[model samples]
Target: MPPSVRRSVEQRADSVGFIAVKRAANAIAEAARDSNSVRLSGAEHTAAYLLTRMPATYAASCKVLDELRGVPVASVLDIGAGGGSAALAAHEKFPLAREITLVERDPLLAEAAREWLPAAHILAGDLRRMTTFPPHDLVIAAWSLGDLPAATVARLWEAARVALVVIEPGTLRGAAFVRKVREELLAAGAHMAAPCPAAMPCPMVEPDWCYFAARVELSSMQRRIQGGDLSYQDERFSYVALVRDPVGLPRARILRRPRHHPGLIELDVCTAQGRRSERATKRRDRDAFRAARHAEWGGAV
Candidate 1:
């Protein structure tokens, strides 16, 4: 095989691979929106999410690894793989990588991904409820870490081989969780690359959400899951925060952009002059907090 022909063959293969991944993402997005697979959220404090929520979640996941890190790892473990969007993206970009594992908690999502992404395998397991997980060169947790109990977060951090990147929805709690994780990792002597490159301190504050995107390919099972269509695009920009607090974390910055998704949020936690107070039960409960803070710190300053 001549070098030019070999290169052409490899390029052709890459194009085919790209198409297959895109097909899978489209199916997952469509299936999630499917009424038959309708997953009602039953009013869980936040809006009804998943299945049909943010479609572009695929690109965001790829960004977490490729451009953001600008470095490659031999292995990747995507915990709570969701619809397998990120896993497929990683496989597409790192064609020669050693291994890529997609860990999903929901059986249906795993099943859908199995057919959607033959190149990338799927595992049905819960990060919060798991006893043990195999170590990998890199770990990516997208929008699933905050839902996990605090104790599990600590345990998972300890188990990471190189770096653990945790992404949560762009919310106050999500941004705050990044700080908490950083503190935990730093206390353990893990490196802190960019504490919050997406924002100065943290972008997960009130009403100031930042965004980014990446190109994600589809899986075979995903196409079967959604009836083999490609008109729709599978994109997402949920709140993303990258933390490389592991042994050899790299330097990066918080990314900012505009998109269909809502930005950062502002909540009325209602504190008393930078002092902790009893938890408030009702909206009015914050009034007392405001008064307390104003009395001590001169008007919520």
Candidate 2:
């Protein structure tokens, strides 16, 4: 996250009282655990979703959008835009986008989105029932594909004229869904645009899933709601970006934080060849070592 945005989030967090926020956070967490639990409705649930989940979702969406930076985007379609986080992130990243559409099932959530994202064309309906989607320059499904079927997801990719980005929670289940979608899209001839070095099969095996984290400053409301005293929170997520046209292939993706030893920098990376550990020594490889020192997890090296 940028310092300016961090400061803005912090200021917003400072404005809300802690106790009420904590209660709302607890309720939201409980509700999220069970799919059969009460539906997200009413003002309190909407407020809870916004205060707790929106920032993390927005931060995750920002990371996904970063992969497509500099691409021409005149139109965007945001699927399952809970409180409009993805739409807001898209607008911030592609300010020139003239047509923005948001598809959300919940009327209350869709209504909330209108207030936050007035410029977007909000479509209130279940995505599963929709047979066709409007083609757009960019299509994003952020933390919204876990429950969707593979056919529906494929339709989403087919509707994208330029790119398709999917973001999911950083969990075992989320990784499984992302991997499944990645394989499906790859088979359909889409090119991997981010988080992967090449279009070859994923090298990571069972019990190990690919995921990344984005640091987001928690609003006072978010901090209090989550029962955390920290100024910022790390939102972990798993994502895949597929493009209609191939972009320059990245060499490899740093899988984790680089470890520095006496005069060596060790990196865990995923390449077309497979997952491997590479070492750069300051004495022998000064430039590579320097680049490794600055490399971040999930970034291409």
Best-matching candidate per lDDT = 2
Who wins the TM-score comparison? 2
Specify the poorest-scoring 10-residue window by lDDT in model 2.
8-17
Q: RMSD of each candidate? A: 14.2, 3.0
Model 2 per-residue lDDT tens digits across residues 144-251:
878788988988998899999998888778888899999999999999898898999899888888999998877655655566479998888999999999888689
Using all chains and alpha carbons, the TM-scores for the candidates as numbered come to 0.53, 0.91
Tens digits of per-residue lDDT for model 1, 1-301: 1233223323433444544534443454454442212332222100112222323455565555554354445677777776565665566566655677788766655554565455665667656677667776567777666656667666666556666666554444555666676667656655543323222233234554433334344333333435657635434333322344332322232233211112221222222122222322234555644433333211121
The per-model lDDT (C-alpha) reads 0.47, 0.81
Worst 10 residues of 1 by lDDT: 41-50
- Where model 2 places Cα greater than 4 Å from the true spot, the runs are 1-21, 31-38
